[model samples]
Structures are given as structure tokens and as C-alpha cells.
Target: MITQSGPSPDGYDPRADRDLPPASGRGDPHRVPEHFPGVSHHEPIGLRRRLALNRMGTFDWDLDRGFMDLDPGALEVFDLRPDEYDGAPMSLVCRVPPEEGIRLDAALSQALQAGTSSYGAYFRVRCRDGTPRWTHSQGRILHDADGLPYRIIGIVREASGELADSALLHSLQKERQRQTVMVQQVTVALSRALSVADVTRVLTGIGGARRFGADGLLLGLTAGGRFEVIAVAGMGGDVPEEMLTSQLDDTLPLSEAAVSRRPSFLGSRGELLARYPRLRPYGEVLPTGSSSFLPLIAQDTVIGALGLFTTEPAVQSTEARNLALALAGVVAQSLQRATLFDQERELATGLQATMLPRRLPEICGGEVTVRYHPASVGRDIGGDWYDVIALPQGRTGLVVGDVQGHDTHAAAVMGQLRIALRAYAAEGHSPETVLVRASRFLAELDTERFATCTYVQADLKSGALQVARAGHLGPLVRDGARHVDWPEVRGGLPLGLADAFGHDHFPETQLFLEPGSTLLLCTDGLVEQPGRDISAGIDALSAAFGAGPEKLEELADRLSAHLWAEPGSEDDMALLLLHRPAGSGAATTPRLRLHVHQADPSGTAEVRSALRRTLDQWRAGEVTHDVEVAASELIANALTHTESGALVSVELLPDTPRRIRLEVEDRSSSWPRRRSPGETATSGRGLLLVEALADRWGAEPRGSGKALWCEFVVPEMPEASARVR
Candidate 1:
């Protein structure tokens, strides 16, 4: 039976026990007297009531009895009704989050098994409203006489109000630091990009995706007021081509961003679909709950746009949007520069192509090919040129040259110099004389540009060559012995520099071409590069030449393909190859022999007729009329000047600049001389007439008499008539 206390004389409810101390008193009801002899039992009971008033709690568990008790404050912290908590430790522990409950149970079990005096833990617990709060609990274990755990008493307090806030602040700070580093990395990557393609590649690769935390990224560039998807990340080939190629006005989000020149965020799939109905299909495919569109602006111009998609709206934080804008700025600047570079490069390439030769000349008994490569860096135009000119008298002139500097000025000077060299060579000047005149011409114009040049004139009939070098690398020759060597030829000062400083004569080198021989002429770019010696380049070229293909065109391609394979080659390159076909005892020129009777002036007519016949047989009728007139003069001179029967020979030199050689041999030791013929003297006019009608005429003394020889140039025939019998 229980009795209720009545009202006291002081007007306080007598139901409240007067002997009981205030709730604030320190006391423990369950403490054994032996353990806490000085503490009163009412003191612990008062402490429990005070903790409950302060919203802090106390709990006690009789481990052996499997019963638990919680103060009103503990029940309130756990958000448990009186009936909900059954005074079982398991029932209270079940209120915690599943993982935290397991952890707390394991801690209690460990303390009980070890018979430890105390243990504490922080864990998550759910309130009656289903909201989670961090709670800290401390408990002490009581043991029985047998040294086994018997009871546990603990205090429980809500910690989330202060402790959780501190942890959240720390996490946010770390995230900010990580974002700063990511932005720095993106800036560095954009800085290294050299071209539009490079920028696009980097932005679409792993670097861009990781920084933005995007599920899909679309990069659209503006050209001619039209927008096109230049690159896409996270969306593989499955992205529709039409979506990538849409015009700027075709879409809402992209156009709106372009017009506003700011970033726009669609926070939910429903909003995106409602605002951009056309993008609904893509939204379904990408499964994006949020998306952002940013205008790529540079120098106040909207050059492009960027679209980023994320599956969860949480990923689209304020920090992420700021990062996206920063990344857009970097990409915009890099892409703008690259786009300009691409345009300029295309224009330069087209201009350079127009300046080169359209076709290479074809020569008999030899093959010729040329290649020109511009600088891989900067503008793709430089001052390098190669030309194959068909000189008079069955000879071909090959030229390769480089002008100082690598700009439009250098290229202009190079073109002028090439034309001047060709004009001088066509005028029948020797290689050295041509360079001397070219140097003078360049100096007079005063373009302030210097040039290095090499010229080689090869005679098709005799296989003889005349080479001249003007501050240029010597030609590499592969002889019939299969030996590759750079001919020993001293070069003069480069053109334009020599005449401006002092007058110097250019040197000429004479060489003969044996069967199966090849000549290679090139600019320094083909052999020289950064961190490499010119000598090493020359040696490497020699090796490449030695191992090159037998075909002349293929060999030129092979050498270029091998040398240009290395990166960072900034100089312009020009290469020319001249190869003589292989075969022993091959006649350089076609010959037709005829014996002329002595003391017969009429034999001159016969010689002309026979020469015309042979020219017809060789399919060289183009020069028949000139050959006849020149032959008639040479035959008449040989018969009238020498005291011997004439041996008339007509030989046709078949090459680019065809020539017909007429030689009339006699037994006299007299060489013909050129003289001004009087109107009355018909005999002296014959030699005069020969010089006027022929391309070149000369006299050589045979064993006893002189052989009067003259050559007439055969004009280039039609393509169909170029074939020889």
C-alpha cells in the first residue's frame, strides 16, 4: 500500500517529500554503500530529477536481470514515449541507427566481457519526429562478487547542435580547397593547348569531366553565327548528330545563354523539359535531374557555349557553378586563339601552294622530282623554293635556294630571286656567272634579305655537270659504285650579302655523271634541327640516301618522310633529286653518219637532206628546218675550208631542251673562225650564217682537219609527239 503526503504548514504541497533534497544535488540511488560511503541515496535521486529538468538524461541497466530504466530526460532525448521504451537495454539501443546500434551493442558487450569499469560512445539516434541527432553516452559497469558484470549506469546527451555544425564546416572547407586545386589544374591545361583541336581534346577528356563532376558535357562553338557541337564528353558516339549540329537559334537554353552571356541552371528534369521541350529526349537518355548552360565569352564576344548535365541536383552546388564559369573563361580564350590560328594556317597553306611549281619537267635518260615543306610552327609559309628549268642546248638547270627570314617578305624576295635566276640561266650564262648576276640583281633591289643558292646544269648528251654553290650546302651524290658522298666544292658568300659588303666571285664545280648516279640538292631544314649538329644531319642524310628507294620520286618522299617525322622542326625545307638511269655502254645521243664526197659544193644540199631524214626518223621534226639551215652552213664550211672528204654526222640529243648536233670532219688542221662577212664575199658569210641560225656553234680540231659542229634547239613538242623511236 502507498500513502500520499498532505500539504505542509509552509503552504508547499505535503505530497512533495520534505526530506528529499533538490534535483540539483549530486546523488546515486544504485551506488553500493561500500563504493560511495559518503554519498546519500537521496543525493543520486535528486541528480536524476535535475538531469531530467535540464533535458539531459540518465539510464541504468541490470545486466543480470535484463531490465533497464531511463529518466524523463533520457526518454525525451530518445523521443520515446513512456510506453514505447520497455525498460530493456536492447529496446533503447534499437532506437539508434542500425549501424550505430550495432556499434553501441558491440562496445557494451566488449566492456561487459572484459569487466571494464567504464565505456563511452557517440552515435546517431532517432527522435519521435524521425529526425536524427548525434548523441554522446557514457556508462560505468558494476560487477558482482564473482567479478562478472552486473549493472550499467550511463548519461545520455544530444551533441549535434554544436559538434555536428563543426564537422560540417570542416567538410565544406576541404571541399573548397579541392575545388581551388581543380581550377588551377584546368587553367594550366588550357594554357598548354596550341590549337583548337588540342583545346577541344583536353576539354573532352578526363581533365574536364573530373573538375565539373558532370555526367555529360557538350561543347558548342560558333562559326559564321551558327553553333555546332565541336566536342562532347561522357556521351560517347550515342549522341545524336543532329543535336550536335543544331543552329544557335534552334535551341532555347543555348540561345538564352548566348543572349544573356551568363550561366543558366535548370534545377530539375521537369523544369528543363518545360523550358526546352526539344531537349526532353536527350534528358531522358542522359537521365539528368539538373543541367547548366554557360556562354563561352572572350573579349566581349560570345564565341561558343557549354552544356553540363548531372544526375543529382545536389551536385549542382554554388561552388560548382562558379567553377564552371571559370573553366568556361579559360576554354574560351584558348579556343579563340586556336580558331584564329587555324584560319591563318589555312590561308597561308593555300598561298604557299599557289607559289610552288605545278608540274616537274621530264628529261631523257634521267628522272627529276622536287618537294617543298614549310615550317611546322607559326605560319606555314617560308622562303624556300626549288625549280627545274629547261635551259637551251639540251641542258637542264636545277636550283634549290633559301632566303633569310621566314615571313611574307622573305617569300616575296624568294620568288623574285627564282625568276631572276631562271632568266639569267636561260640567257646561256654559266652557273657561276648566273649567281654573280643574281647577287648583283638582289643587291640592287635592296630587299635587305640574304639568300643561299645552289645551281647545277647537266648536259644530257655528254652526262657532264657544272655545279655552283652560293653559301649553300653541297649536293649529295650517289655514284655508280653505290657510294654516297658530298662533293668537295667551296661555296662563295651568300647572295645579297656579298655585293652589299664587297664584290666576290662565285665558284663553279665541274663533275661528270656516270650511269646509275644520282644528285640530291636540299635546304638546311632537311638535315638540320634544334639540338642537332649540321654535320650529323648531313651524315644522317647520307645514310638515308644510301638506303633510299631506287625510284627517284619514291626516294624523295622517303627522305622527307624520315626527316620530318621528328617534331619541332621549324625551318622550311626544299629537296630536288636528279637520277641518271642505269645501263652500261648506252649512247647518250642518237647518231646518223654520212660520207660526203670531196670537191663537191652540191654535197652540202645532200647533207641537209640526209640530216632532215634522220631528224624525221628520231621523231624530232620540230627542229628539222633549223637543223637543215645550220647543217648546210657547217657542211659547206668543212668542204670549202678543209682539204679532205667530209664525214657528216647528225646526232639528236633527246631531253627537255632537245638539240640537234651537226659535225663535219675533215683532214685539215684549220679551225673555223668567225668574221664579219662583206656583202660581196659569199664564202665568209657561211660561218657567219651558221652562228646566226644555230643555238651554239663551235669548231674542234680533229687529227688533221677541223670538225665544224653546230647545235640547234628543238622546241618542246606536243604531248603525243614527245615519244621517241
Candidate 2:
């Protein structure tokens, strides 16, 4: 039997063990073995105190002696040991029930000898009625100075209760695990914060105090002493939207908890009522059971508190509290991070705009439009730039280029490259030559970035064009000999990839002008990007071009709209074009006839009047004086130089400034040259002055001495004015 050594206190009692028979020689055989399980280090514990312990007890070893002093129930169920195992160590004697053959004393003795002071063991032991049961016995071995085991005092407990408890504990643990995984998934989703309400709702519904899960809250207390919820999650049901949105009294329980910043539990019904008298009415009115309030503390001060509620009182488990606290921390961090990121993005967007073009300059020969979109705000804008330069020869140079990335540096490089290209082209270099030099210049800049470009040179005179593609889109040539002839790739390379790329550039290829022909040049960004293959983009352009060039501006707008159709087409782009007129420059100058006959001055005057009337009818009367003078001079030369044959010729042209210029010729080898001021006779002066007044005068041998001619400006001069006589 287990025992304590001292006299018993109130509510405690002693027990006697009389299992063994009287010994033959030891103490008249009255003392049998006794067990003192779980004894403290002292002289020894008597039997009285052991009986008072709720978790401790002794059992019968032999059936005979235990029945005398025990109650009938105890007697019927157990038998005391009278003679077995006298004075044995408690570790061995206590396990006499549900017996296993692995002698407890022997095993414990072995363990003690090995310097093991305390040990726990599991084994089957015999019960009082001889039933077998699994028992777990534990004990501490007392050692003497020589390091040998002197006594083992311990307790033996039935393992059944503990085993069942273990199963319950395992189930609880699994539930906690599932809850934890769900919380994590929701936390991840909420972290994205695509929308404030959505993110908050998702997180709160999953784990916030606002829903039926663990929840945390942040609130601002009003002048009153009641707590008002600001943000909430994990609580069962809504926070009475009014209660959450309205200001609460500072002295209220939740607010007080927040202000004090102390962690408190409100599980019992009485505790809930005492903490919040207002809640008493709520409970009476609604029949609620369990809740836990955790203060939202920052810098040692409560700013808010987390409240969790459940239908059962078990809602206040440790897991709930832990999750609530963690959720509170996450909300605070997310708030701070999102605010900072938004501010930073705004600043970046402003900076990007400063580097982009604001407006496009008006240029002649074709319309111009420019659009610059910074690479999605908060990111850098790429090095794409476009410039339309009016060249000296009445030609236009269209340039577009892209540097490597989207950043302030790339944008700066783009500006510099644009200026450089314009300067080069203005110096009279062909488009190909300009690209070659630009490439070499870009390569040597050492920016550790590459660039691509396409330059188009338009010849206003012949309406001719030359294109150079530097790792850029080939210029789209539509409605020429071939309706869709891309810029010829005779030889070109991108700028900046290497050093030797630009110096010895190939000669620019020439293309003949066709009526309604158009040439389009652009950066790679225009034709090559995601959401569509380069070929598809090219085809799209071809289709647009084939639709006729009248809708060019509309086409550009359509292109921009198409780009946004697929977000992946987020590359910088630009378009440039050169259009040719319907009539070719090489078309024969307009022909008409101008005749001078050997007639009277009145006849000449009559002819002049007729010419003036006809020219005036055609809106070309400005040429009447020059035509009259040249005709008079030609007729005078022909009449003076030869006998009687007269001729009149007229031609029209479409060139600028001199839209119409003409030559008067007669069969005379003697060309008209300006005579000396004094030597100029009347007839000689006529042709001489004609030679001087006309832009150009000449003579050719027309199966005769020569054909003399004098040129005169037509009525339709593009820029210069004509003087008629």
C-alpha cells in the first residue's frame, strides 16, 4: 500500500496494510512489506496521507489481509496482500495488479545501478481481482553515498485514461492544423490587396473577427467610454455595422482594454457581464455564449482589440487567440506598405512624364502626330523617340529609334540620339549614311545599352525615297510598282550592338515614285511585340495601306487602339510616312504652242491681245508680258536672221516655283547672247533682252544653222513671281 509518513491533516486519512502473514523471526512476523510510492525525500511517509490524494492510492497484493479493514465495495473489488512481497519497493509492489512477468523491482534495480535516478515504464500488471491491465509506472530511485540504489519510491497509474485523453488531444491538434492551413491560404490571397474592400472582406471572412473565425480589430475610441470597432475579422456575424462604423466611448470594455493594452480573456458569462454591463442586455436579448477580446497594442498602448465569438464556450482556445494576434499584425503591416507603395508610384509617374514629349511640331509635305506613353506608370519609359525633320532640299527626314530599356537613363539616351540624328541628316547625309554614322556613335557612347532605328529620306523634287532600317521595322512601301514593297534591306544594322556596325554603311537603295505611293518607317516597337507575330503586324499594316492612303490618320488611331486590345503589346511604337502625288515628276512638261509670224506691229498686238485673253481665261495671264516679249524677240530674230519661217512652242510643267517655264525656238544656228550696252542695236537688243529676262535661253541645230530659243516663266509659279511685259 502507498503511504505518507506524517500525521494526517483535515480531509486526509491514513490506511493500513496487512497483506503478509507473520514472519517466523522478524518482529514476531507482524510486519509485512509496505510500499511508499511517490514519496518525497524525508524520513518516510506513513499510510494515512496517501489515502487523501485524489490521484494516488494503494492496491491489494494478497486477498486475505485487505478485506478486514476495507469497505465492502473495496473488499469485493480488491484483496489485500498478507504475505506477498514484504517491504518491497513501491515500484515493484504497486504493480501487483494486471501482472506482467517483467519484474518491476528487477528492471528498476538495473536502471538505478546504471546511474538512472528517475524512470518511466509501461507494462501489463494484475488488478485486485486478477484482471490484466496496461499500467504506466514512474519512480525516482534514492541512492546511497556509494552510488548504489537504496530505495525506489514511485507511482503506478493505469494507462487507459491517459490513452483516451491522447486520442482527444490528437483530434484537437488536427482541427488546429486545418484551421492554420486555411488561415494561411486566406492570408496569401489578402496580401495581394487588389481592392481594399475585397482584400479586407476575404481576409476577415476567412480569419478576421468580422466572420466566424479568429479575428482581430483596430478601432478609434470616441469621447465616450465605449469601444467602437474600426476594422474587424474572424468574429461570428457582422460587428453590427453601426457599432463598427460609429465612434465608441473610450471607457467601454473593449476600448478600455485597447487603451490599457492588456490581454484579457472573457469566457465565463459572469465575466462578460461584469466587463460590459451593456453586453448584459445584449446577451439577455440575444443568447450569446463565448468570446475572447485581445487588445491591439502598439508601442505599449492599446489602439484596438480583437474580439472572437463562438456558439460554444470553446471558441476561446489558445489557437484562436494566437491567430487573432497574428492577423492584427498583418493588417497593420499591409496598411503601412500599401500606403508607402502608392506614394512612391505617384512620384515615379510624375518623373516619367517630365521626359516624354508634350507636343509635335507641324512639318510640311505630310501631317505629323506624336504620342508618348510612359512605360506603365511607376516604371521607366523606354528609349523610343521620333522626329520629323524638314530637310534642305525640300525633302523630309523621318527618324524613329528605340534604346534598350524603360528608365530615366533610356529616355535621356533617346533624346540625345534624336538630336544627333537630326544634326547628321541636316548635314546632307543620305538616310543610310546617317544611320551608319549614328550607329557608330551610339556604339561608342558606352551606355551599355543597344538601340534600333529606321530612317526615311523623302526627295520632294523627284518624289523619290530612300529608307534605312537599323534593326528596326522595314519601311512599308505601298502602291508603288508593287503594292506592298517593304523597304529594301540592301545592308543595315542596329545601332550600339557593336562597334563596327555603322562606319562603312551600304549605299541607300532607290525606289521609283508611283502615284499614290506611301513609305512607312518605324521603330521595332511598332511591328514586333507580344500578342501578335511580326508578320501578322506587317500584314495588318499592308491591309491598312491597301485600304488606300486616304485614311492614314485614322489608321494610326486604329493602330493605337489595337495595341491596347492586347496588353502584351506594351512596346513603344511610332509611324512615319511619305506620300507621292498622282502624277509622276518625269511626266512630260505640259505642251502648248507659242507662235511669232512676220506681221505688222498691230498683228503682234492683236496676237498679244488674243494670248492675254486666252491666258487670262486659263488664269495664266501673268505670263502674257514674258510670252509677248519672247515671241516678239523670237520673231524678230527669225525674221531678221532668215526669210519668213516662224514657229511657236509652249510647254507646261509641275515643278515648284517654276510650275510652268517655256522656250521659243526658231531654225537659226546663231544663238542669242546679250550684246554690249552700246553695241546693242534694236533687233539685236530684242533677243539679247529676251535672253536676259528669261530664266534660261538656248539654241539647237534643228536641221538648220540652229534653233534659237528663249525661256519664260508660266503663270503658275510655286513661290517666285513672274514679270510679264
Candidate 3:
């Protein structure tokens, strides 16, 4: 029975209304009202009654004039009285929410731009009681002879019942789908958690609130009859200290859920405060609306509880409840697994630490520091180790090694190997000999394990470094000027494999560490990261070392702190640092030590080269020729008379008249005796030559051996003698 002024492209014809009864006079049933100029009032009296009964109202809008007229029925649909609205379209805006009004405007504009003949839309209208009601509007565009839109005629009606019958079912289905997706995403994230820290990070990190569709999330664990808060996300205000830890029997909601192993739901914060009045102090900081607390259970054990909060009233449907419970189950499993991994890792790390030296030995003229860090991700211990052994002749031996594999067995092997290496080094064996014996010992063990090691024999008094490696990284040296470099050291096969491969020789490299310099030796773990080239890590380490603090302790701490910034490293690491301080003025004499094997023909030539180099550095080149001749004769006599190799030392004496002192030590007890012989006798002329070329000479008993010594006068260097750059 709804009427329109003109023919509606939406099937409403104005001609049909002409068949109704004629008007008697003013106020007749068949006459249109003056207020509703857009409505065709020629309808029958029964049609008007039927239209009013159905609660359908008609509207006419003049686009050109920017005005609209609503019938009495349309005013009823908007919950407005006849006297409340004007004839303008904007007069009805008070009934529609801002968001709904924007949507309706957009729809109308689209239809006008598209030149559509008709359009329909549904929107929410705010009632007088401040509740939103569903309403539908249908309009047909009317055009003039020029094909331009001049007016619009349509009808408006209440749609609450219609929406209740169809839209409700669709809303329920969408909510179910959302819940399922939440569960799947949470499960997938938890699967990668390997520790308690990892699990909490995944739950409380970015985007956590949106994934769970909650305004707040709180997670806790039960320990020693107390509940400990682990993570909190999306909560407002500061949390009290007492709330972070509470007894299991406390009246707190999370504690109750954990102890009872059940789920509790509260429709609002008011209900929570009413049920548990003890929570009143925390009410201001807690989330509003509804909240749910579910116990985290795994294998029939309650380990903790999880709390979820929303800002709106909860539906309390079966699917929502099930989703919460499923999420709780997934988290419980991950937490339990992570806890076990932590316990095992703790035990393994303790065992690994026990295998290392309890304390580094204090050495004169040098400061030493060591650090051992376990792998950050696994349950098994690694084989990295560090040791400092005090050797004879005021020297120190620095060792860093890693045994193959990560287990208790690896730790045991490392302990035995460390002891053996320490004993061999302390017995005055050379770096090459120490590693060969260590490899032989490991090969003899019943287990099939190998190790990589870098050993440095440091002569602090002489500033001499002899380095040897067995399939390991070479040591790094930082000079007094903060320049860092990695000296080349040749390597052999790894221990236990050296004997199997029939290669037991590890060649030694000689380096000079000036006073105030530092030597660094570490396992590869310190410079190795998964998927990255090792050279990059090495370069980074070198840069950090060059920029570190001057003090040994502070530098060691700074390097250790870098480990916290890098993640996902599966290997353990060991570090050793030795610093040689620059002593007072000329009192610190420059010295050099070179070892000469009994049968090594090249040993003499290498010693001569080292002598030239040391003399050039000290600006004592005036006596180089005499010192070289005397040293050669002494070395030949020792190699000829001693049953073992010799240790040669050359030092610049700091006295009124500076002198260069040379000492050749051998294992033979027989001392050198000056003897006169025939002119052509070659063997007897060695000592004669030493005695004639040196300004002074002597012999002394040095530990199970004899040290033949010589000295030569060296004039003060001229300023012009400095080497050209």
C-alpha cells in the first residue's frame, strides 16, 4: 500500500493509484496531504489503512532542491514523532550513528555516479534509548527529459526481525572460523620453543594480543608451592611486586585456577571483585568486561595457569570455551618440554666446567684471563676448554682446545687430555712435541674422539712467541698501538686422527710480541656462526678486539658481553687472553730466544736471520757481525757436544756502556774449556774463535745443562742510523 509520486523504476507505478475513490472536499480520504507533496494520495482508504498496519513508510527526495519529505509511517520506523523532524534530509541524521550515516552516504553517492535507476541499503539507527536497531532503505532514481536525475522515491522499514532470521546464523559461523584459526597459529608458534624464555617471548612479543583476540594475557608457573608470574601482555598500569609471586593457596584467581586445575570464567570485573574481594587492590589495573582463567595441564599434572581478558561481554559458547582449553593444552606441553631441556643443559654445563682448569696460574711479567660459555640452545654440553700452564725458564704456555662431539663422554675425554697436555708442557717440552704427545695419548684412548688445539709458548722476558696448532685457529696479537693481526701458523691433522693418518708433525711459527702487547687464543666457536663465512666473524672479532679496553679483565668482560647479542649459536666457546705490560724505561731489556734442533741444518740459518732482525730493531747493528760469528761457533759446539737440542738467548744489557750478551744452553753437563791446538785442527778452533771475538765469555750450570755465554761492546747508535721507512 506504500505510494510514490512518479513511476519508480523499481516497479512502483503511479498510474495504479488513480483508480481509488475520488475526494469529497478538503480532508477527503482520496486527497493527498499538503505536507507530503511527493506522495500520491489517490489511493483507496483501505490501502492507506493496510500500509499503516504494515509499518512501511514512503519517502520523496528532490535532488535539485536538496530536501526530503517523510510520511508518518517513515517517521515511526526511525522512532521519531511527526513534530520532531523537518523536511530536510539532514533532519534525520540524529537517528543514525556517524559510522552508519557515512556508509549510507557512500552508497547513495555510488548509485548516483553509476546512473543506476534504483538502489537498496541496510544500516543501523540509534534509538531514543541509545540502542542500535537494524533498518532498511530502498530508493529509485527519477530523471528528467535531459536524462539527469531530478528526484528519488523510496520506502524505509524496520529490519530487526529479518536480520534475526538470517544474519545471526552467518555471524556464528564467522566466530567459529576465527577461533579455529587462532588455535592453529598458536600451536605452530609454540612448536619452535626450546626453552622457557623462548616460550614466553613467543607469547608476549609483538602482535600477541591480536592473535589471541584478547585485551590482556597473563601467564605464570608453579614453583616450590608458589606461583611465579612469567609474562604479562596488554595490561594497563604498573603491576605490584606482590602480585608477581604468590603462594599456591592464595585467593588470587590465577593461583586458584592453578591449584584447582580447572577453568573459571567471570562475566565482568564486578563479578570478579564480588567473588574474590581480595582482588580489589588490583581492580584498577586489570582489564574490563569478561575474563577466563584456564589451568595449564600436561600428562595429568597441573604446571601453571593462563589468564585471558576481553573488553566486551563474552559469548560463553561451547566453541569459544573449547578453543581456550585447546590453547592452554598446547602451551602446557611446550612449557614442560622447555623446563626439561633447561634442567638437562644446566647439568651438562656444570660437568663441562668441571673439566676445565679450576684457576689459571699467575705468571710473572704477564696477566692471563679465561672464559668458558656453553651453547645457548641445546641440552648437551660441548668440549671447549682453556688452560694456562707455567713452564720452565720464566715462560708461560697458553692452551685453547675443543674435543670432538658434545656429551659427558666428550667432557671426560677433555679432562684427561687437558691433564696430559699440562704435564707435557710443564716438563719443558717444545710446543710441537707437546701436541704430538697429546695426539698420541688421545689415539691410545679406547674412545674414537679427536681434538683441535692451539698452543703458544711465550717467553715474556725475551718477547718471543712460538706457536703451534693442530687443525685449529691461530692466535691474534694486539700491539701497544692497538693494531691487531693474526699471524700465520701452519697446522697438522686434528688429535687422535693425526696418528690414524700417519701424520704426527705440527710445524711451529715464530712471532714477536712487544711489551704492552696482548695475545688472544680461543676455540672456533667464538668466531663461527651458522650460515655465515668464518672470515666475516674473524674480521668482526678483530675490530672488537682493537677497540676493547686496555685492562685485561675489562677487555675479557667486554668480549664476553658480545655473546648475549648474537642468537641461535649451537656451539660452545673458550677464550684465553695474556697481556705483557710495558715495564719502566731502559730497565726493560730487549731479548730474543730461538730453539735449535740437534740435526736441523736450517736451524742455524734461521737463528742468524733472527739475530740480524733483533739487532736492527734494537739499533745495535754496530756489533752484529761479531755477535753473529760468536753465536755460530757456540751453536756448533753445543750441537756437537750435547745429546739434545740447544736454546739460544740474545739480550741487550742496559748498563753505562751497553753490551749484547749471548747464551747457548745445552743438556750436556760438560763445560766449555779454552784449549790451544795445532793451526789446522778445525774441532779445537771453535772455542778459540768464540773467546777471541767476544769482549767477555763464561760458562754456568743451568738446570741439568751448561750455558756458554759471550758479550760484545756496542757503541751508542747515531741518530742517522734509524732505518728508512
Which candidate gets the maximum TM-score versus the true structure? 3
Task: Give candidate 2's whole-model lDDT.
Answer: 0.53
Q: Give the range of the ten consecutive residues with the poorest summed lDDT in model 2.
A: 21-30
What global local distance difference test value does model 3 have?
0.79
TM-score of each: 0.54, 0.42, 0.62
What lDDT, from 0 to 1, does candidate 1 have?
0.72
Predicted structure with the largest lDDT when compared to the true one: 3
RMSD of model 1, in Å? Answer: 24.3
After superposing candidate 1, which stretches have Cα over 4 Å from the reference?
1-173, 204-208, 211-216, 238-240, 252-262, 266-291, 309-313, 349-351, 362-365, 479-483, 501-503, 514-517, 583-585, 588-725
**Residue-pair clash count for candidate 1:** 8
Any runs in candidate 2 off by more than 4 Å, and if so which? 1-175, 187-352, 374-380, 459-463, 477-491, 501-503, 510-521, 526-533, 536-554, 564-725
Count of steric clashes across candidates, in order = 8, 54, 0
> On residues 565-602, what C-alpha lDDT tens digit does candidate 1 reach at each position?
56757888999999887773355655555666686566
Pairwise TM-score winner, candidates 2 and 3: 3
Expressed as tens digits, the lDDT of each residue in 1-725 for candidate 2 is 44446433222233444342221212211122253445555755444333312123333222123221222212211222444334333433454531122234324423543477776654554555455444555666555577755444445544544545586556644754565555566457657763334444554554444332533433333335455554554333454554554334443456555655544556655666777776554444222456655554433334455555544455355444445555544444554454455565556556645544455545444444554444432234568777777788677777777888877788777777777888899898987678878877777677888788877776645655566667766566565333455533444456866355423453354443355566666665655666667888777666656554355666566655554234555665655555664564555333334345455344345445544543442345456677667766666667667655555554444455444344445555665565565654444477566766777876677765566565555545443332221
What is the TM-score of candidate 3? 0.62
For model 3, residues 37-79, the per-residue Cα lDDT tens digits are 2346684354433444455567778787777877666776777
